[model samples]
Target: MEMFRGFLFISIAMILFSLNLSNVEGRIHYHKKQKKGSPVEPPTYAPSPDDPVSQSPSYPPPVSQSPSYPPPVSQSPNDPPAVPSNPSDPGNTTSEDCVFDVMAFGAVGDGCTDDSAAFAAAWKEACAVESGVVWAPSNLTFLITSTIFSGPCKPGLVFQVDGVLMPPNGPDNWPKTDSKKQWLVFYRLDDMTLTGSGTIEGNGDQWWELPCKPHRGPNGSTKPGPCDSPAMIRFFMSSNLVVSGLRIQNSPMFHMKFDGCEGVLIEKLSISSPKLSPNTDGIHIENTKSVGIYDSVIANGDDCISIGPGCSNVNIEGVTCGPSHGISIGSLGVHNSQACVSNVTVRNAIIKNSDNGVRIKTWQGGAGSVTGISFENVQMDNVRNCVIIDQYYCSTKACQNETSGVYVTDVSYKNIKGTYDVRNPPIHFACSDTVPCTNITMSEVELLPEEGELVDDPFCWNAYGIQETVTIPPIDCLQDGGPEAIGESGTYGCY
Candidate 1:
């Protein structure tokens, strides 16, 4: 009876796989606990039209038997987004006229001291002065508690972080009066440069063990609690900002979050966190515009860079990401919300030993459109899902599929060469049945297996696109013939 049940489960899974009805989890964990066998070799060309495997453009069959149930959904560490610190000192060599040092405003550089007040005082002083410098002296570890640096500050203010700034020890150490949503926030600031080769540490060891974290519960279930963890640094509703030349690490949640901000430039930085740290996204940008992220190294638990809802005109280049979930355009349109994102590009990047390469994910029951995005000149090494577009992204297995879906179209992948982990498919584009992805183009994509095994085939469902050049591990799965509504564009601009 047990053997019969197992056989029945395998038959059901095989039917689902053949019909392209399986979810993203089913596709990713297709190799879970399988019996050892000879690796399936990648096909050099598309299957013949009459071939049984040629019925769909979705991925070809694996050698292993399909599992009974889908794997658990990988939830983002960030949830229940309600919305969207400190200081200081002067032992500086730069003798600027508008220098407002925190130490001058009664800031103790001691690592144990709560210097939030002093940092706030210095910012207040400098916000009024043009081209002012809020200096945190070198060789100091200034401990700061929760603080919000509200701004519409004077143009061209520089917050030179030459030392270390750390938050409170843990949740137990947090002050009841302060909100745990975000630790240090630059709110509504303009023409500011937050730069310098300094370190901003979240001291997030305790936060990772929280009940709400992904690995804390049985089968990745969540335990009940306040479950709120603070983001390390957030720029909210700020414009003309530059965050560069810093080392940020170990965030309770997202290391850097930009929400409702515009005209931002992030460059020349190193961001990191433990691979086990929950939700420690290197940099997260949302509801922001005209942002450029360049020349950065990010090794973190979550996405190296995440482009969230209502974001446009984002450009990322010269980034090295590893030991992380690679750059993601989203798990957007969550909870049936509308997500509008466009004009994003990620190029000249390297992603190694990451869970994903370049991914664009959206939930099932949502509205809005994602268009005019391109991923070019990206190199991957041992990446699990080298390139993917998963429209039915549910964080829980219990989520029911909905007809309403976000529109994803006009995406191009160019010069994406890499070696992928033998586990997951090299490319997976599982678009919604309702709103099919259109005008997807790929060129010069060569993904081989990192280990000495055969490469996996690309997977596609309702993904209509044109391949400009022949791709490695041939994307025979990508469907041809896009809709007439696409190919030509007005609002999203001609790709």
Candidate 2:
């Protein structure tokens, strides 16, 4: 037929060119085995999403999983549990239907039922849930009174409070128009977070047995009229705040007040009262700013962290304070008033059995200025005036020495090791014949004498600074800044 139809078209064109070269060598051996299994080796440490430990540090990832209680006990077993310097800190994060369950808003945990209208209707539905959480469940004991949970909330709200909250059993059930001065306020809030592991209990004996309670009058005297007791948690004009792991005890007067706050973060708190429990004061800051009192434990009756009068950038750490009145920054500008504290910082503290250890009282004529203060790594046991700076602060002993004080400057005392209760003077520093406390600095101060009595000699006046590494009973009464020798025209004379 035409050479057998051209041999069937040359055997079908050599079997279609050998099946197109075996499908092009099987797609070039499947792209050379996917280019030799290319994953491209690019991971060495690769974790930075803001790195809260790129892979494992557990992180602030343990507010629960089993926390039915047990962890607040920290009186410095070397204080190792204060996390949150931003382990994803959104004021200490929380979520899940925005958690608002104070016994589901009927709130009768039963410690005598007054739950303040179910905690003001669960803080008005957790101030409208944005990250809200009003939950207070664990062992349960509610009982509030003299409330006021007002707020401009919904920005990470969280008043967890796991248990007891008692108040209102003293001052004859207190209602005489309620302003006993505070009792759990929290007005005008912002990113708030009053944490858990609860217990508020301010049933302050009968407002500490009234008569204006300075131990009920008689020589530690007080007999004034209203004298308003009560301040067991105040926080007015708040900002991104956080008062953590609370356990605040008997109060009737100052035990956690922070007014006009801003970025506060009092952590791991556990304030108690009665050392004679008079003015209470265990964590009070006024007109606060960038505050951060961390890892706390204050025993109490005034000043276990009180830095009042327009405080600025305050920061205390690993606290563990004492049987009262030790970490104060003021009696500041009282009444002659016009204070202005600045950048205060206390660090790694532990002032046991204290009456005074790192104080800085001011009162005489009171004008402005207490600048950049710092007391570092302090640790005193039998403490009683182990580093003071009075400025003639008189609360009695018939006052009167006014001259225009309060200008302590750049104060610093670092690594203050110690045990001192030789009565007083382990470093006194009177200052202010007219504001004469300038640039004082001490380093590695070691104050011994727990009762082996012999360490006194350190009582400067019109203080003036600089001792770098030899200060146990040897500060030699710091002086040397002149205006004629000390102040007011000098020669040192303000007793």
Best candidate, lDDT: 1
* Model 2: per-residue Cα lDDT over 131-234, one tens digit each: 56676665668888788998897776667676789787877677787777787899998877777676888877677778877647786677988777778888
What is the lDDT for 53 in model 1? Answer: 18
Instruction: Kindly list the per-residue Cα lDDT of model 1 for residues 380-422, writing each as its tens digit.
Output: 9999999999988987789888877778978989999979998
Model 1 ranges with Cα > 4 A deviation: 1-95, 483-495
Q: What is the TM-score (0 to 1) of candidate 1?
A: 0.79
lDDT of candidate 1? 0.78
In model 1, what are the clashing residue pairs, if there are any?
A: 57-477, 85-184, 89-103
Best by TM-score: 1
Per-residue lDDT of 236 in model 1: 94
Note the residue pairs that clash in candidate 2.
Answer: 230-252, 487-490
- Per-prediction TM-score: 0.79, 0.32
Global CA lDDT computed for model 2? 0.73
The RMSD (Cα, Å) of candidate 1 is: 28.3
lDDT of 1 at 391: 89
